[model samples]
Target chain A: MSQLKLNTEGMKPIYVQIAEWLETEILSASIKSDEKIYSQYQLAEMFNINPATAAKGLNILADEKILYKKRGLGMFVSPKAKESIQEKRKNQILKNLVLELVTEAGRLGVDENELISMIKTSNKFVGGRDHERN
Target chain B: MNVIESRGLTKTYGNLKAVNNLSFDIEENKVTGLIGRNGAGKTTLLKLIAGFLHKTSGEIEVFSDNPFNSIKVSSNMIFIDDKMSFPASLHLVDILEAAGNFYDNWDAGLANGLIDYFNLNPRQPHSSLSKGMKSAFNMIIGLSARCPLTIYDEPTTGMDVAVRKDFYRALLKDYLQNPRTIIISSHLLNEVEHVLEDILLLREGQKCMHMPVEELKELAICLKGKAGIIQELATGKEIYHKENIGKDSAYVVVKNDFTEDRLQNVKLSGVEITPVATDELCVFLTSRNKGGIDDVFDRN
Candidate 1:
């Protein structure tokens, strides 16, 4: 959707960035379940990246069972894509992010209870809103 | 399979070896970047593949046949660069029409569309266009030809940044519809890095690194942190670049893939990890007197 702005300067690999970008779109329901996803060719055109590199991104999602191929019809989001994506991100990314926050909080003398309370209170303000800005 | 392959290929001029004993393959349907510093024999290699230059020794093959003045190879390939010449009497459209006679895969509609997109005037003489306009026109021809093997050696020589972006966007768009083997040799690595499937690094005419851009990114990453900690952490890693940032702080480019498991406490403490863009990587790898990048790769 041209919403994904890649950070070429960052340490993150490009394929991983592409996968994460598509994942965010999937999680937001902007790209729905059972819907045909962008082919590697389309992704290559859209992002000005190599088609092979784009295919690798698609492959990453396929490996995670987030996207599945349909023979000649191209890749489609799995029916349980959103759930799997949500669960995976929560366990993998969000957990790591929260852990980092807690580590920083601990370093700053903000104890466990204070950090937990802060998160709980902050959740209310950010409730019903996607944390990632489109 | 490789669309183009060379084994111990050597091209010399007088006493100087323009291209040393080089060996590499150009994989089919992939956009490969052929990059090197000045006088690194990039143009010579392209010419050899194009049948414009004869190799002094070793083997070179295109589509399993020698490309030296072969009609089969010439018909299937398109080569464009800054030095590309056109008949002074021919108009832009006239030249394209003539090109159509040669390249069977030529798409006239695509050429016309590119003409419109690049704002190239068909009525104008090819020689009359400015430096940037000529490059754009050349790019249009290269993209529209849709040959099995297309080589553009510094195609964006005089084109501006916006024009270069347009060229890449157009190339990718067209390439999606019709897959082909494309070799783009450019000094502007930052612009072409993402679009390239693989990179072929050449130094003093020898094949250096022929790696996927993604893997190369992982292999060579810059680490910024305190000098002491940076040095301690860089014990066994291949250091690409090391520089003093300030009085006690330094930045080092280590050939670490920056895997998740590789990220340790020292990283969270101070060391800021960043990716080395293809441009910097090329400079570091090709810069003389610091030992070659190929030599430093202990893993390979």
Candidate 2:
């Protein structure tokens, strides 16, 4: 958490970044299901941000069911949290990046076939063959 | 509960109105940033709230009582600035001890810990420390006092970069542990914006804008592209700033009220959109001219 450096210049707000970072942490299995997450105060202290902003981020996850709140206790990761986060990132984040990629490819006069082949070749180069088979 | 409230609050010095017809309510347990340019009446307004200065007209309240020399307001509020001073004969440690006597919430342990952490010589007089060290020492007292209504008017005046960062973090941590209504007036909003829940922006002794920090961040957006297309899209919108990039290109900052579809179409049309930073937005909002300093140098 101490190594988390948010990009203050980007279009995304700090709370959104914090939410995404927490999702990534869960997806990476660093925080297991039903594990307690950092409180707003803890996140605020770690990020040097307003506690309200940090709480907003925690609320975002709570709303999405990626995290749940226990009475008198802090937020904890929900069961299947990683799977839900992956599903969300796939639909929102990955889709947006692919949209931008396709738009730029079109502007560069790269046809659909060429773009598809380029993606496959790049994937292979990055050792994605095992995932590809899966 | 409102810790401070003002109604048409005005203060005058000779013919100049330092704070003019300002009305606002500062809620309890929130960190609000009071931002403005130099001589923007930040200090004057803060002094009025701290009971150090009287209002010439209208009304100002601290804890529902008139703040002008009121004992209740004076006892509950602590105002820290770069010019904070102590008696010439009092040593650094004695000054801290004296400050503890004034505020009921003072944490002597925290004060002593901070004094030792900053490596200040307890035996030395307050005036003998370097400029940066003096500011650090003053900040220690301000934080340890833990007054309900704490006002810091450019409290980081002489501190170096590292000390400034440490002070901001410490302030935030303390505020979280003990909720209080805190107002910090500063010129360095970029560094302190993250710690603030609300911002009260002043321009020429008047309230330019006061809103939550999140809303202020989204108040404006910048567009850069062909000047003709930019002008076409910017029509009927409030454009706060404009600058020509090249002969054919232009950059304009306008209100961020456009709908998602409109922004997508504008991007599809090749106009690049960018978020305006809080500090930049403040500058643009308070700027006298749309062209800024470039207008002064432009002979055309």
Q: Which candidate has the top score in TM-score?
A: 2
lDDT of each residue in A1-134, candidate 2, tens digit only:
45357889988889998998899889888999999998999889888899989999999999999999999999999998998998998998898789778888988999999999999999887777677777
For model 1, residues A1-134, the per-residue Cα lDDT tens digits are: 46246788886788998899899889888999899999987787677788899899999999999999999999999999999888998898887787678778877999888888998888876873654543
Which candidate number has the best lDDT? 2
lDDT of 2 at B183: 97
The regions of model 1 sitting more than 4 angstroms off are: A1-4, A106-109, A128-134, B257-259, B291-300
lDDT of 1 by residue, B139-192 (tens): 989988899999999999999999998898788778878989999998778888
Per-residue alpha-carbon lDDT of candidate 2 for residues B11-77, written as tens digits (9 for 90 to 100): 9999999999999999999999999998889999999999899899988889999988689998999
How many clashes in each candidate? 0, 0
True lDDT of residue A101, candidate 1: 86
Task: Tell me the deviation in Å of residue B198 in model 1.
Answer: 0.9
Candidate 2 residues lying further than 4 Å off, grouped into runs, are A1-3, A128-134
